[model samples]
Target: MRQGKVAEPVGAMVIPAQRGGVLFAVGGLNGELYVNGQALTGQWAEELRKHVPELSSDLDRLQAMRAEWLDSPPQDRTLALAGACTDRNCHTTH
Candidate 1:
């Protein structure tokens, strides 16, 4: 584990089944949320929220969107995330 980081195994939870076919797991590291090894934004909007409730509604929404994009061809995934970031003003540098 990384310094000042916490990891929670989401393996027991079935992501795809619960979130419209998006497979992912939640992990907390350095007060951050990671889903299936990738850092999550909408799911981890706040650091404090990480220790509290499950944020199921937001998670479901993000997961559904992710599933929709993942269902697209590999080359399209980048485009999808990029578009989302732009729309959300995330300003991700990629």
Candidate 2:
């Protein structure tokens, strides 16, 4: 209930490869964001959003990638979509 504290485990999806440690939590207050116990400012979230849009379209792509990871072994194809995102202006065709 305190400010900047995440009290509950909402939902989490693990990214693959270099980003495998990322976590996502919905239904919680817009409190401080953290990955592996390090605190992050809201700006960090905003920056990530800019690179990876949270829109349903983008998420659908990620979901598909996750599904593909289940049977076939992970490949460069799975990482092509998001792994290439480096600049702040990187945008995926939706």
Candidate 3:
């Protein structure tokens, strides 16, 4: 995986659903978060949290919902880590 470089993703998990929107977590290389090559700094998580907060006042219920989502089936999937892909467009996957 590119040695100790953190900018490149060492691994990735893709969960595809035919009837759902997209939610992605992009980890920066060298601690710099970017989207379409634009740096987001500390605003990404904060912005997302504000838009999609806990689903309920009960933490347990929220946890259950998260578990359910995680357990759901995926349409097409890919599990990748460092050096897993050798492509010019390795920066992203559709």
Candidate 4:
């Protein structure tokens, strides 16, 4: 949850992280994206855009999703993802 690391209900999510992979930039969730700890500066961001051409559009979508998630009232599950399990692998009781 902090610094791109999910430290709860441990599983595969932590393995790559433990090995120094950038799982995700937490700031991206807030619209200000980053890679590792540094901001995705203009030059570097362009370099990344070459490989991920839709990055800009995806960020736009992310903002919209955020608005819905934060501004809307409670909603039902899109899929039966909730279940009583400590970890994801065992969370199949939909």
Model 1: weakest 10-residue lDDT segment is: 10-19
lDDT of 2 by residue, 1-94 (tens): 0123346422322332232223332222222223222333344444544544543233444444434444452333323444523334433322
Off by over 4 Å in 2: 1-54, 77-79, 82-88, 91-94
**Model 1: number of clashes?**
1
Please say which candidate is ahead in TM-score: 2 or 3. Answer: 2
lDDT of 4 at 37: 35
Best by lDDT: 1
On a 0 to 100 scale, what is the lDDT of residue 43 in model 3? 51
| lDDT tens digits, residue span 1-94, model 3 | 0012235632231222234322232333333323222333335434433433431122223233323334552222223222222323333354
With candidate 2 superimposed using the best TM-score fit, by how many Å does residue 59's alpha carbon deviate from the native? 0.1
Better of 1 and 3 by TM-score: 1
RMSD of each: 12.3, 12.9, 12.8, 9.9
Determine the C-alpha RMSD for candidate 1 after optimal superposition of all C-alphas. Answer: 12.3
> Using TM-score as the measure, which candidate wins?
1
Query: Which of the two, 1 or 4, has more TM-score?
Result: 1
What lDDT score belongs to each candidate, Candidate 1 first? 0.37, 0.35, 0.30, 0.32
